[model samples]
Target: MTRKPSGQRGPVDHERRDQIIAAAHEHFRLYGYKKTTVADLAKAIGLSTAYLYKFFESKKAIGEAICSLCHDTLLSDIQAIVKDNITPSEKLRKIFQSLAHNGAELFLHDRKMHDIVASAIEEKWHAAIAFDQELSSIIRNLLLEGRERGEFERKTPIDETCRAIVLSLQPIRHPALLEYNLETLDNDATMIANLVLRSLAP
Candidate 1:
């Protein structure tokens, strides 16, 4: 939210903010995130650029909001997998496979939306930061559960192991790198998960 100098209008209208984001998502899909402008979004949504700024500080902020929404949807899918009544090892494998599958799907099929996320990640937007942190927590929790159940080794520090696992998956998980390894992404994801599981075995 932006600060009003003095005597602004009514409260920060969330309805209007949502309207802007909805319009932006469509326009961005059509025009690509790099080419779309804030003025273009405002004109499409029947709002003034200045008015839009009241809800979002800048064009990137609007993108961040959309990115966050997308991340939430993806996170929901991950959380579902985490909660499934399956072995921790299976959960770990499925999680990595899902991440690779989704990343490839977005990059190969939804290139426009993928660009928005690529920008967010490359720019280190708050949406990307928050998503990464939440994802790390999820992975850490899964590791802890596996260790508690005697499915994984407890000798290594869990934090270090979690960090290594995430780093190992970056090539498949990252948008920009997804294209380069599409041919072998699935195999690589499986291999990485297997290696991690083997390392974690009690």
Candidate 2:
């Protein structure tokens, strides 16, 4: 029987890689990134540490994969909101609310997970930066739509306006800020939406 070439992964290898990532997520959630080790993750998935390393380079890599999964899920949710058939103003409001609501639920619910997220941001992980850029682009697209639909009067360049909108709503959109005062996200979202809308009025 012929064996697969070295470094070539088959279907089973992919499945095992996914299983390791899933198990690592749970371990990170329960034990936090700093405390979780490759051995713990490998044992949870019924694999030896050396075998797990064939899938992930290190425990940090596993943590990064978990973080990427979360960011991808968030981007999907925001993309859905952006695609909905609704007025730009309403979409903006919903987007603000969703950012705060979902971020708080994901990070604030578990202190260990929150710490992991904080560290990711501090380290400027590639996934985290990509997530932020995508979100900013979504906001930019919404602003352009508002301008095209005659819902907003231009006071500045569209790009600048979009940046301002994102910066202005940072308290409700930034995970760290949201974590600091989650209880007021709902009220703050409403107020910020109204203020932004009024500023954009013709």
RMSD of each: 4.1, 5.3
lDDT of 2 by residue, 1-202 (tens): 5322222234434777777777777777787888777787778778898897776666666666677777777778878888899999999988878877777787656666666666677788765676778878988888889989999987778888888887877787566777777878788888898898899998
In model 1, residue pairs whose N, Cα or C atoms come closer than 3 Å (at least 3 residues apart or on different chains), thus clashing, are none
Estimate, for each residue in 75-152, the C-alpha lDDT of model 1 and write its tens digit: 998999999999889988998999999999888887888999999999998888888998899989999999899999
- lDDT agreement with native, every candidate: 0.85, 0.76
Q: Could you tell me how far off, in angstroms, the CA of residue 116 lies in candidate 2 after the best superposition?
A: 2.5
Candidate 2 overall lDDT versus native: 0.76
Candidate 1 regions exceeding 4 Å error are: 1-13
